[model samples]
Target: MAKPQKRYVCQACGSVATRWQGQCADCGEWNTLVEEAGATVTPFQAKHNLQGGGRTFQLVGLDAEIALPERMGSGIAELDRALGGGFVEGSATLIGGDPGIGKSTLLLQAAARMALAGASVAYVSGEEAADQVRLRARRLGLGNAPVQLAAATSTRDILTTLGQGTPPALLVIDSIQTMHSDLIEGAPGTVSQVRASAQELIRFAKERGTAVVLVGHVTKDGSIAGPRVLEHMVDTVLSFEGERSHQYRILRAIKNRFGGTDEIGVFAMETSGLSEVANPSALFLTHRDEGMTGATVFPALEGTRPVLVEVQALVVRLASGATPRRAVVGWDSGRLAMILAVLEARCGLSFSTCEVYLNIAGGYRVQDPAADLAVASALVSALAERAVPADAIVFGEIALSGEVRPVAHAALRLKEAAKLGFARALAPVATAGEGGMTIDSFKTLGSLTDHLLMR
Candidate 1:
């Protein structure tokens, strides 16, 4: 006969507090704490834990032989590539992205395709009405698909209905944030509610051997909203990323228990639906003008695929007594600052009096450290009013001491570049020339700057 205790949880970081507070002590965010009811445990219940009530599982040896898990393809090559082949039975997947990033569209397309391929698919939308989703499906030319669609937010109703029938091969929940669980006290998007709802759905997925796909909303900083444990509860985590003004979207695999992580699937959003891009390099790399200054081609490797993108830089000298401005797009500003510092201190380049602007062409974001060489080449070319070779690609890492460092998959990058009609490479000295392409290797960043200046 104990009273239920009240607890406050931080919606930002899932930290629990005894009482309401203005700021979350763990995440330093203000106005995110919300109250929730904690379970009541009597004194007898707390001390009556016995070890004999649980069923034990058999321990298996590491050398035990087993068959590979069966996969169900969504009939999309790029998506299959990112998923490390296809969706596995009894696996739970969580995909998150910013608003209007085509997450629901992509999932709808997959569900339609799977339904057409004779797989039992169910799509439950919590944010949109059934008629609205149907209208979109018709617009996407999937009106004939036999996909079971519903628009309900109650987790209990969804589970109860699905439990009465044969379990579907695939179940897609459009947006976990809008799902409400009656067992939890708070609203849908609260930390406790999201965690409890996801746990229930994942349990259903495991017990019924259904592959579940859960859509998630993202915070302002682009991380998945709700509890961080939500990501860990799923068997796989995918990120859908794209700019609103851009036509291309990338599906990146952040975590996978059945496959390799960091794999990416490229797609372009069109009027009809999302179409897979087999050659993503073509979308990110713009046409190279004959003598375009401040531009360099870079080979970026994502998982097993190689993509070529262009790096562009601009430098304008500012008048004395005026503060110089630094601007960047589609790349990290902190990394750009580091590169500028290295060029000024170790390579004898002076950019203090100039305003610098850096951009990655075609709205593609570059995260590879190998882009350092390409970025430096672009900056040096811009400041000196010179142009890098139109057919040459650049990739390598630069240290603070100015030494050019070799990168992973050098031969793979060269091979990809060669396939794209590039004949020369400006890379680290340790990188060997492959596939009959010439390599202008530099040992240090100082040497690279000298070469660019003298060219």
Candidate 2:
């Protein structure tokens, strides 16, 4: 018999090492490495396994007939939208978010709604007691929902209880980090433990045709707290994002094997619980004063939905020899630097001696490159003390050479903007706006700057 080797795994990132180190080399977290026990490797085992003793399985052709996976609607339209229509039977979904950001509330709401709609739903919480969950459900006006609830941290006990009965249509694990598996030697939340617990639950789902929804805890950086493989093991990954202070929450699909990625469902935290926001643009857009200098509205597209958001900028001239600070919120800082460079080099606008602040209103983050034109418009409007027309929306990409570039779904963006009562658009040249809105097209950054200055 050969002695088993001691393996160390990083708790922050699932990297393995032969020995412990002060800091993890992969994720650079200090004191995160812990030892785990594994089976010993024997020299003769490698030589003996050249051929397999497994039973043969049939292989199917690419043209084989198949049926689309059936879906189970959660009875909540917003949750179903984030889930790409509805939850498919036997699928595993992982949802992660910051603490106290309404993860439990949303899941409880879904579970209650599904139960009320006559689906067999089981909600197991490792983080809360059954009575606590019941109290919350009652507070959410779901006191009469017939959903089955339990408080268990042991993976074996939870699986065994569910195995004895007819499998439920849905099973919700309140959080994966708190789940413990006796098959794994490490404690819960460890790399080995999370991987093992999730694997077992996913296997149960597959064998029993139960749609499993696992709530995950996010790290300080907002990524799910577990082995990265946990995300890959699931059929869908949903990110719940919102500030605790804000009333709005966004459920964004990061990966969906069955549907389109980047699809988002919007909800607002209300006294009654999480209510669907039918018009997401209303949450992100504030009442703009007429002749406001530093604000421009940009139509942002997420998956197939178009939402309008406000881009705000403020520029202040600095005294001589003072360091000018650049600040940005809800948008990329590097892109801001690039836009400033383009404004100075290609458009002859000087910002080297001025402090600049840029913000996306409503704490809504913008990742669309099309917002480049909008940000530039707001910056120019701020610097020149001129207001971008309140009724006009701006969206386009800016090239390094200062040319304004057209973005995708220009027609779709215009349609949404027109429906919101916008009367005009400042877009790239050749963008077709056939929606009865006036289009003021620009070719270059200099021309856009000239348009703002002249106005």
Candidate 3:
């Protein structure tokens, strides 16, 4: 008899390997390899599923069948817009967040809205009892009586029950971490179990044409828990993020095949439910106190929305021998070090003696390189002991040559800034702003040194 196939997989990025190694060659993490029974399905398998022997030379440019009745409303207007107007039939959405970050609440709201919109919705809670979900639903003040809730952790029984239901219904599994399958012997949240469970869920959703919303948990490292393959298998992936002390939550898409990924939806938690924030720009603005150094506004774009957020910096004499500790909450730590190096070398600033710390308030994080200009300004302002002009917003990236590089959507950033009543903006020469404000362009940090240093 032929021997059964065996291979190893990386737990972080899901790259397969035939040999067991101490470190992953893909993601470069240590001890992440696990033995698997069979080889992973390649993208070629997907192509073969459609190609059928690769002999077709038929007509091209075929239009997609846009079905009207299959569309379902998510009840939240901004959320619906982020989903390309509404949920498409047979699409899968993976909602992820940290504990107590309102992942369950958001889905409960969605299920209630779908049922009220005339679509039969079934919400299966693997993490909570049916009574617990009912209590939370009542706390959210949901009065939509059409929705049904079931408590089940077994994936096989859950899929069987879904088969008995009528077609054209929405199914929600809250969440994937607590879900289990008899096919996998390990615990539910293990790397192997998660991969297997997610595969089954995806297959069920695809064959049944049921829109599946899977709630996912995030690891302590702040990434979605489970194999990375789970993310690539979904049709859309969203993050529900916010500071627990604050009542606001932001729903942002990290990946979407059907719609623009940059779109974001903001919500204000209330006694009733999640209320949409009509103006997110105003939410980030603070009540100004005079002469606060190291605080500057940088117009940043999230999806298409332009938000002017305050970039804060603190540079103080080091109290410990750890070499000027670097701490950042929402921005990249490596980028912070790069910006500091630019200040020390190109800008001729003295940062060796001081410890630098950067933070994005309200637990908000940004990955846009456009934040570079704001970070530079914040550091310079703190070093010079003068605040940046409150009316002026910053934009651009700091290069090793100290040049200011342009970022995309500069016009939108300035347009929102103008509507918010900002007057002067220090933007890169690469981007000239729209009307109603003066957009000054800079070539390098050396050119803007006088303005930032003297305030």
lDDT of 3 by residue, 212-292 (tens): 889999988778998999999999898888888888888888888788896788888887778888888777777656688
Model 3's alpha-carbon lDDT is 0.83
Q: Over the stretch 1-455, how does candidate 1's per-residue lDDT look in tens digits? A: 87777899999999999999899999999999999989897787767877667889999999999999999999999999999999999999999999999999999999999999999999999999999999999999999999999999999999999998799999999989999999999988999989998999999999999999999999999999999999999999999998988899999999999999889999999999999999998888888886899999999998889999999999999999999999999889999999999999998899999999999988888899999999999999999998999999999999998999999999999999999999999999978888899999999998999998898
Ranking by TM-score: 2, 1, 3
Q: Residue by residue across 1-455, what tens digits does model 2's lDDT show?
A: 77786899999999999899999999999999999996787878745785798688999999999999999998889889888999999999999999998889998899999999999999999999999999999999999999999999999999999999699999999899999999889888999999999999999999999999999999899999989999999999999999999888999999999899999999999888999988888778889888899899999999999999999999999999999999999999999999999999999999999999999999899999999999999999999999999999999999999999999999989999998989999999999875899999999988989999998
Residue pairs with backbone overlap in model 1:
none
Colliding pairs, model 2 = none
Local error of candidate 1 at residue 124 (angstroms): 0.7
**Whole-model Cα lDDT per candidate?**
0.94, 0.94, 0.83
TM-score-superior candidate, 1 or 3: 1
- C-alpha lDDT of candidate 2 relative to the true structure: 0.94
What number of backbone clashes does candidate 1 have, counting pairs of residues 3 or more apart or in separate chains?
A: 0
Q: Which stretches of candidate 3 lie over 4 Å from their true place?
A: 1-70, 183-187, 317-323
Q: What is every candidate's alpha-carbon RMSD to the true fold?
A: 12.4, 12.5, 12.7
The better candidate by lDDT, 1 or 3, is 1
Error of 1 at 272 (Å): 0.5
Model 3, residue 319: what's the lDDT? 56
Q: Pick the candidate with the highest TM-score.
A: 2
Q: What is the full ranking by lDDT, best candidate first?
A: 1, 2, 3
